[model samples]
Target chain A: MEIVRPTLLLDKETCLRNIARMAEKAKAKNLDFCPHFKTHQSAIIGEWFREFGISAITVSSVQMAQYFARNGWTDITIALPVNILEIDQINQLASGINLNLLVENKESLVFLDKFIKFQAGIYIEIDTGYNRTGVAAHKTNLVDGLLEIVKNNKLLDFKGFLSHTGHTYQASSRHDIFNHHFDALLKMRSLKNRYKKDWPNLKLSLGDTPSASICDNFDGIDELRPGNFIFYDLMQYKLGTCKFEDIALRLVCPVIARHASRNEVIIYGGAIHTSKDSIINIDGKELYGQVIINQNGQKILLDERNYLHKLSQEHGIIKVTYKDFNSFKVGDLVEIVPVHSCLTANLMGSYLTSDGEYIPTIRQA
Target chain B: MEIVRPTLLLDKETCLRNIARMAEKAKAKNLDFCPHFKTHQSAIIGEWFREFGISAITVSSVQMAQYFARNGWTDITIALPVNILEIDQINQLASGINLNLLVENKESLVFLDKFIKFQAGIYIEIDTGYNRTGVAAHKTNLVDGLLEIVKNNKLLDFKGFLSHTGHTYQASSRHDIFNHHFDALLKMRSLKNRYKKDWPNLKLSLGDTPSASICDNFDGIDELRPGNFIFYDLMQYKLGTCKFEDIALRLVCPVIARHASRNEVIIYGGAIHTSKDSIINIDGKELYGQVIINQNGQKILLDERNYLHKLSQEHGIIKVTYKDFNSFKVGDLVEIVPVHSCLTANLMGSYLTSDGEYIPTIRQA
Candidate 1:
């Protein structure tokens, strides 16, 4: 609690603010606030969302769902395509709670249908252009077959189609993200209308932080599952989705060594702690993270030219200004706004709240 | 102990073989084998090296040094430049056993001299073209100043210059790696020769997997500190340093979804499990990791076409050949040879040994 090495510092106020804002946004849009628990990966953090009346949750892995379920979460949707290998655990999970799964193919559907003993909700993943995963929106034949298989299964409850417009992270401006969101809305709306006759209460799910944060048009969606909004990072800040203040998590690294000639301060943090997500800055330099100063218990994001330039396994080099180099001595704790908070949170495995309370990772539990 | 999800699988036999081979190399070369424990970051793995008659060890963090020290590693080197803030821990650690610290500045040396209650071995980190950290190799003035400060300090034992020939990773072939190693060898030998008259027992410390693995030319180096060789990754294999069989670690991920048309399989492992270290392949495409098949208990590296192309937080997209894709189902466990095993190992936090024993991480211990 005395803040010694590269510790992930979480501000509860900022974090709760972020969660409340997103939950309110969903409420205003008349959409289901199914917050994703993959980012924080903590049952304690899950309780924060629960405080805002969020019950339906999204997670990336079955192991995660089990972790949350063991901690008393009931309504869970694994946003990732179901790992049919984990059917035993899935079946066990679904038997006791409202378990939702994602599937993109017939083999997965058939396997679940044959093996599942309990009622399960199924969401067909639609690929709107991310090309990462999901069936193509234009593939009507595939969608129809997928739906047919789900309908045939007595235990499986056809939820709806889920699409994560991940490419919105690549959008150049807020307007660009809005366009991408509109495009996804149109795609999901069309699919929802097409299937409304068959399944009357089909819900279209859209999740992605940039689109959810930048765009206000959530009229056609039934649920919103933006996980990263809980701890918006430098990536979101650069994408214009969140301000510096909204970026809640900061890795506090100690200044280990100083290279005055280079105007650099080596920190006791690296790829292991902050991760290797570097962003190209305006100066054509790759910034692993931005330096921020924790003054009198308040974190002030430094808009200075100083940057966390490089990171090895356990070493981070922060290129600082001459004044900064002279002011900070070896062993001083400098807060860094990580490029991606989700990955950083995962790597750190836990968070040290600013109030000095140690929050255990869901994995730890 | 059935691997439920994204488990870090370590073949202990292969890992032991790797350690033995490196220890044997160091023995034959007449150099002290101080293998960096940063790769495994496990006290159990440290004990594996101890079985090979390894007494001293190298680590990247002070906390890690304490972890290994607590686990019975007496002679330890905190290889990264000393974080002046951890003087208390360093002093406490040094008082118990032989503790070596890296320093590149007079301020750090002065602070250590004034505060350190126990004697400490100091290694001036020399920059050998990596430019990431360390004092530039050509800066004799800086080196002399650093040496003078150490020599002036009564508690500080001035160890020889330590340089990591990291540029060996950038080399195209084994010949190029040899050139980088040879260049570093010359620079370190020159530094040693220059200071040999004053400090006869001063030994040169060199590390980096590519330099240590590719070239057997370790005539001048007094200590070999290569870490990554123990769990050689796709990066090391690509650098022509380690053979495919030498790779000791693999991430076992389950296939969640299958895209038959594009021959892509969505795996339940991603940036969170595998640190995003992508390497450019022969076709000039960025590859996260290579898919390896388990055939009759032997792990076979699929080197031709399959690649872990894209990764989200918990999703890994492996683009594969149609035949290979068809052969595997949604529940098959595929091993991936990570691009950088050090970072990958760091992310996973623990290992499931081939013997089915769960190895606790250094942090856990």
Candidate 2:
């Protein structure tokens, strides 16, 4: 692709390999591999997973479900807690497909039952340790109360228990990820064992890229919904979840100016292009992103010694040793591995594929 | 406006007041009031500045300059350095109107001279202390070389020196902001003074919200281009650049779930909507944003004691005291004073005015 201001470059080969790896893992475990489409957010990219016979998918919002549903995704689970205000959208999205909504309380279930005209699958979101959302797994009374309301409503189908181990992103080591994944699996299994007698076909779901990529003990988890594996970022790399070769996306920005005195090269990418998500550096500064040099269309990740250290609104300052900094002049294309790929992809609404094809994502208003 | 998800709400009254305030400041200082339109990247919001008798404006990208130019803006200076890859678009933009391009190196100037067809004004960007981009103010030989080349070129219109003191954002006290502003003013003045004998009507420009809002000295700075004053956010509020009442934009999001045990409320807004820019709270945790209850159509800023404490990809956890938490019910709208308004505005891409009108921003594939 031509080097412009800032282009999000996607390597289709790497993305396909990533998709295949996760799909094969789920198949090996005899689990439902419902990859979360929120990471790629592209119907074209989603089709790459269809080659693996994956039909059901997971999204974070109702609008996303509608987007993918219109694009021929028949079954979509909105993994976020139900926003009662979006009942109209939820009903509209559920009108033609098997739409799933997560609920932790009876208020949302009652609101869905009263407003939604079409059949909507409901899942009681269990807090398996993330603590960001979802009901505590030990809160059996609350879970039963929500389940009771969901069961009483003819329009609502009680799907199962769903939980997301998001805290794995903060894990310091692979052991931490496995421990979090283990605890989540134990709580979800215990909850499923308690309620399986009442509802025979309820499915247990766990989704998170870090745990899903490293852990193999998926014995009872019915469905797996790991996104980000398709385009693992620096955060995943730091968490020891994915290797650098599996990263499918890189932000190609133009070198605007060079500060040879400071050994810094500034680019046209910043917090807007790569959202202010960052990991702590060894020097205690926020590592906005890392610099990579592309040779013959292959991205070569640089050493951690040189990285995009500081960012303003529309400017990124990369601190490099003179040898690394001397390799580029102004107006040359500089590739950066964003701190978080999902946010970077979101900021860049479209992508230029490796074959020089521009593909629009599902972020347009 | 009905906010089913995270909605960017714009208050026209306060925004106009802010525009008037900065314009009046520039008028009082005998400086050109060329405000930066990068913060509120909306043509409708741009029209608000026209009411203050402002014509020439500054944008951060060529796409944004083209956007405003297509909507009848005649003069726009792209504050970013010229990217050689966008030479075609720059030529197209420069053909119809008086376009300004920033250049700091000889390579970009040579490319523009060879490729650009229309006359484009050039400003040599000087670095005061930000170290993000631009040539150092002390590099007189480099500046003189660039001037010699520009003088030899017919298509390049040489404007004066321009520098932005971005370090003002990191200032601990008002005294630090004053000192940073003072240093930038001195460096830019010395550069302009060195070249003023050659070019009689050279214009010196400086832009940044924190320093511009606090500093009264504009001895040699000929133009002011402050942007964030239009929608001052938590960062500016913390830096004493703007009052909370002057903050015109707020992200109105729905409360999807409430965790009473943790005294936390989960909102549908996340890093995708807020951009993950944060500040430190009193208790030493990162505060992504502060919660403000919308009293009728007006936003009332709450105490900093209760704020958004944690964030995930699609969820924001607001740590609230029970009293503040109980005031908000699930599905109730909560306005967030984001840590940085510029990034938040870019993410939302549109706004719902307080007068109940929807305004679409200039962001599309």
Candidate 3:
């Protein structure tokens, strides 16, 4: 099969191995392994997880939950804090599957109670360190207030406490990641204990790629959800979450134009194919991704010290240095390890297997 | 009409006005107007240009040209250099339309001659300051050698020179933009004069958002092509290419969560919705875009001091300043003018017109 230029190449063997490894980790810990569906977003990829005896899943949005529901996934936890605006969609989702919702505020609880008629598990999101979302972890009153609403309202089911330690992405070393995971688990355990007297069967859910990938100690946590582990990226590699060899997805882009004077090569892959996510390399330089040999599959350390400096609508400018300058020519295909593989895979909209097979993907509304 | 959160909004009136204004400028200069389709990438939007009397159009890829061809656009130019890998697609395109191709080297010319059967107009891309692509403007011998290939080849029609002065994006002021335009045109005119002695009726096509948006002078050029004018973004606004009122596209996002302590608002729109392109403000601080009134339809300064700093898959972190912090609350929708509107629009798949209307977009393979 003739492979098209600027296509995503997925190693099926590597991908399946990664899935099994994650599932094995969850099984050994005797924890509920709700692998985040946001990473692979494909029904076919989801089938691989199902092959490993994974039934329950986690999604970032109500729309994603709907997509997976249509794909025959019976149970799904919409991991994002319940956006009251999507009450109709949530209600629609709940009518079919065992839909679980997340809430970080009182307003969401009020909105859910008014709109939703069916009983849906509501997980209170605790903000351990990632200030992006969720209520403060130590806010006992906030948790009490949410539980109070649950008691008064018969529509919602209190599903204990949930936290995503997203700050683990900023970890510079393995120790930093382990510490973040340990601290977050302790916080979640404390929150569950605080509410244990009332609920008695409270569950503690912890998530984040770094926390789940590096640390095996999940003694206090009842469930684990790590998404990006399915196809780890350069950022994950830098954070010590996953090694470079473990990355399963790569963008195969053909060199359309080569600028010999400036030591630059223009690839068909752009910001649209590989996302604009960047990571500081071992040399302490910012790079979008590293270029690897298409045939030999060896890493090419290009000069000019830049990975992808500028990206237009359909063009990727790869800045090259002197040592690696003479190696590339026009029409040569190079595989790029995207900085954020999950986002990049989502953006590319399609993927080609290593053996040259096309797998179409549907976008979530 | 209930609107979905995190959608691209296009003002039809502003879009039409911008189109008419560009057409008027091209008419006054006695130049053919061929708007680049990369900005919109919509068949419906292309039809709007056609209604405005646009006969020819420009696209960044052969696939895009094919897309417009299927939509009944005949006169199309693939703006980027002819990729040898895509020669078959270009050949298929040439069979349908008056396809104009861009080329920078002898190798591409040689490779294209093998499969190209029909008469295809070839534009010798001249590098004028922007060292991204094209042959150096000062290289007469190189130009002569390339023209010789056109003279020897019967399938290729030498349609003179074309240039995209992308350096205008970095202009400090309106004068700087004008100077960049002036310098680019002067160089193109000199090359045209030098080549006209041998091949008269040589067409000079100069394109770029800055030149097309601001420059009134187009004395020697036969055609003007600019794509980004259809969706004027914050970058264009900062470059003085277009006014804030002229920015036709905006990402309509719903406020999902808010943090009172940090004075930050988390929105459903993320890096996927708004590409990571950013611009510096008046105070020398970087900002993505301004946040506008959600329901009031009034323009509000987004407390430019802060930023939409970190973004997850479906979440955006809008750092709220002390001034605007308390003004915002959970569940309030906001409009963010993307730093680069074209990239944002492309990533979004298409636009969701205000009033909850869905506009389908054409995607290139």
Candidate 4:
């Protein structure tokens, strides 16, 4: 059961616990949970959600939706704004599953009308001040035009409204994120009230990792979709979303070489495993990630004075300030907590469970 | 066979031409070409090198070596310092292929001695001022200790000295990169001379994308191991490594939605496709990449005044200028040349060939 160092180690227990916690929160709030699958795109991982009585999911692309759809996910909301160029795939997906699409403009609705045959729920994404995606909430005419096109079409169905407050991730504190989420929900509620007389059964959905993790109140929300909670990373820690112990994934790396003069220790893990994602450490120092306890399970931070400053394709350079870098001799296995687990997991390709179990990751093209 | 937008498109012809060009360069210089597989990481792509008469190949990991080994690549040099924790896999790999290991110190040589049974070629990695990995060239004692360990271990064969002038990538111009490469070569030559009496058969190996792309001289080096030339990217263009047209990979994305007031467009492509890698534009503007003419293959500067400014997991926000905002409607497809092709290709799991062909990428993990 000797797994290779610099490999991804997934704790199944923590993973299940994370999923259950999110599911429980959604259940308690009476909100439909459509967890974003982009965080962990494994079908095996999706099956774990099925165990929680979850039938619906969210994916980033049509290819990802098709992946989950083939694996028995019945209802899938393509969280991204529906690109009309892939309307053919949307038609195929809708014919099979309850495929809900997101659109921010009337132009997409007009394009979707050309290809869609079955009634598909369309979620109009509103940009509630997050300058990323979605149409501005005040753009009522755009919504009206979209609704008119949907009403005219035989296959299109106007579901409601959706928005992702992605800017919350950049929030400096919990209060900032909570306020952002609350304000976003208020905007969505106002949009819903504006169209409630016309469309009484309209659904209001909002999703974002920062808002979903910190905000406890979802009083007016209809559905919740957050992905990164499955494997909280260093960013989540910085955002006060999760504690360091809650991180479910770690890169197991081995000390390959050490330089005495520079007090730098080279490890097998590099940008490929830990990714280029970095954050300022506790000492206000920039570091790729904290060096966790090695095989001994002693979470030893390799001298705070030293930092993993640079990474090559396959080698990590840990600049140590301590004179005795020899403590971590060649062949010693070490674990690195990646700055971003989603990107790291995606880059690493597969994972080995804590119990020496190997889980091959499904490729998302 | 209309392919999905926001997909990586590869020109097989261009790839073959690039491979042939590198191979011809090595042949003319009488240098052994062990092209690093970290760039392509594809067996099919490696086959093109074999077609061009390349027998030796370089990989970043033992796992990668195993991947290429399975695909009939025999002479493989694992470019990173050997992690003894993966000795079992290395032993298994050595049994099947002509495996060579990289080491910077005697500690790694001592650690590797216990597991290797057959004589494995060990390449001493010298740091020619890169300060990333490898032992400093001035450290003759470290090299002596490494040689002593090789002399004591019957199973280990001292192959040569290797150095990756990785700092060349950070060079300001072609002249800077050329000087960096030249200085690294001179350092390697001095080290070779220092060990000439002890190891007369020692080979000199040098590699780096910037060095290979910018420097025409490979005079003193025994082998070349550049990888990024197979698929150039935005960083390469900025480094003066390749032209805009020479870039072999592009993310073909579909315009999903548009915002009129802000004059912004949302595309299906995001950080997952093009990566979070960004570069400063000509006007000291920071941008992820330039949008290309969708069908015409023309480079569209994306109205530099308004370019792809931000990216979420699966959503790319293109801030459009007020003037050209109305010209781009939903359903339009756009192509984006990525900032870092290696990371983009790794993220993009597969590629859509130029002739409407779908090619699934081989997973190296």
lDDT of 3 by residue, B1-365 (tens): 56556778888888899999999899899998999998888998888887778989999887788888999999999888777787778888888789999988777787887778787999999999988888999988989888888998888999889999999988899999899899998999999889898889899998898889988888789999998998898899888889989998888788878888987888888876788777877667566677876436666756566567667788988877787776666677778878898888888877766556677677532
Q: List the residue pairs that clash in candidate 4.
A: A6-A252, A6-A253, A293-A298, A293-A299, B6-B252, B6-B253
CAPRI category for model 2: medium
TM-score leader: 2
Two-way TM-score contest, 2 vs 4, winner? 2
Report residue B233 deviation for candidate 3 (angstroms): 1.0
Error of 4 at B261 (Å): 3.4
Interface RMSD for each predicted structure:
1.6, 1.3, 2.0, 2.1
Candidates arranged by TM-score, highest first: 2, 3, 1, 4
Best-matching candidate per DockQ: 2
lDDT of prediction 4: 0.81
**Which 10 consecutive residues of model 1 chain B have the lowest summed lDDT?**
B295-304
Runs in model 2 deviating more than 4 A are A294-299, B294-300
Candidate DockQ scores, in order:
0.71, 0.77, 0.59, 0.64
Of candidates 2 and 1, the better by lDDT:
2
Candidate 3: DockQ?
A: 0.59
Q: Mind giving the per-residue lDDT tens digits that candidate 4 earns over B1-365?
A: 67556778898888877777878888888999889988877887777787888899998888788888988998999998887778888898888778999988776777787768776899999999788778888888988888888988888889999999988878889998989888888889998888888888999999788877667877778999999999888888889888777788888888877776667778888766777767886667667877765435555656466667777667888877787786566777777878888878777767777777666555633
Indicate the residue-level lDDT of A252 in model 2: 90
lDDT of 2 by residue, A46-160 (tens): 8888899999999998888888998999999999999999888888888889999999876777778788899989889999888888889999999888887877889999999
- Candidate 2, TM-score vs. the true structure? 0.97
Quote each prediction's TM-score: 0.95, 0.97, 0.96, 0.94
lDDT of 1 by residue, A1-365 (tens): 57777889999999999998998999999999898899999988888887899888999988899999998999999999888878889999998999999988888888888999999999999998777888899888999998888888889999999999998988888888888889889888889889999999888999999988878888779999999999999989989999888988989988877777778888889888887888997689889999986567785666648889888888898888876667567767898989998888988888989788889886566
